[model samples]
Target: MAPRDGTPDATGAHQRTPGARELNAAARVFALLADPTRLHLVWLLSRAESDVSALAETVGAARPAVSQHLAKLRLGGLVESRKEGRRVVYSLPDGHMKRLVVEAISHADHQVTGEPWHD
Candidate 1:
């Protein structure tokens, strides 16, 4: 497919800092986190894992709504869960997911706080 800016063959993937597959995966990740609820979920997961009920309480969202969001995250491979009795504890899927979430949150903080990192 052509690039979003209409540069199908323009110096594009041929010289990008990242490969097409990597860029595509990144896009998928961002798309998943595009929703407000999803972003909040990622923000919470950035800290530690929690069950759906705890997530709902912390995010001020309903239990079903929180579960739905967790489902999406799980499908996207950005989250993983385990059963602790009846509660399903969710956490960042892996180091890659953690890096992506942290980068997004850092970018957001920079945008809002106007604080740029030299490195």
Candidate 2:
């Protein structure tokens, strides 16, 4: 099948398209990020590893709400946590997630500020 972008697969053989399951997984991740609070949490985590309290204070959200968002993010594989003494520090698992959040915020900023899109 033709790839979604209409480009040949990396193999340079048949065009590889994303299957329904792959699309659904991506959609589910986007759905999880649809919340402003969650997106804020992700943006913060993208910067550095932080605990719940720090995340809450930084985002101006309640601790519980931030914890809940962190929980969801952790479950979705967007973030990972490790026990640091008595505190559980959360951080983005990889650079891919960080780039995704950064690009999303940049896009939003452009739209909000009426800036022209740039490559």
Which candidate comes out best when scored by lDDT? 2
Best by TM-score: 2
Candidate 2 lDDT: 0.89
Model 2 over residues 1-119: C-alpha lDDT tens digits? Answer: 54656465775433546789878987888988999999999999888889999999998989998999999989998899999899999999988788889999999999999999998
| TM-score for each candidate, following the candidate numbering | 0.76, 0.85
Q: What CA root-mean-square deviation does each model show from the true structure?
A: 7.4, 4.1
TM-score of 1: 0.76
**Each candidate: how many clashes?**
0, 0
The local lDDT score (0 to 100) that residue 91 gets in candidate 1 is 92
> Model 2, stretches more than 4 Å misplaced?
1-15
Instruction: Tell me the spans in candidate 1 whose CA falls farther than 4 Å from its real position.
Output: 1-18
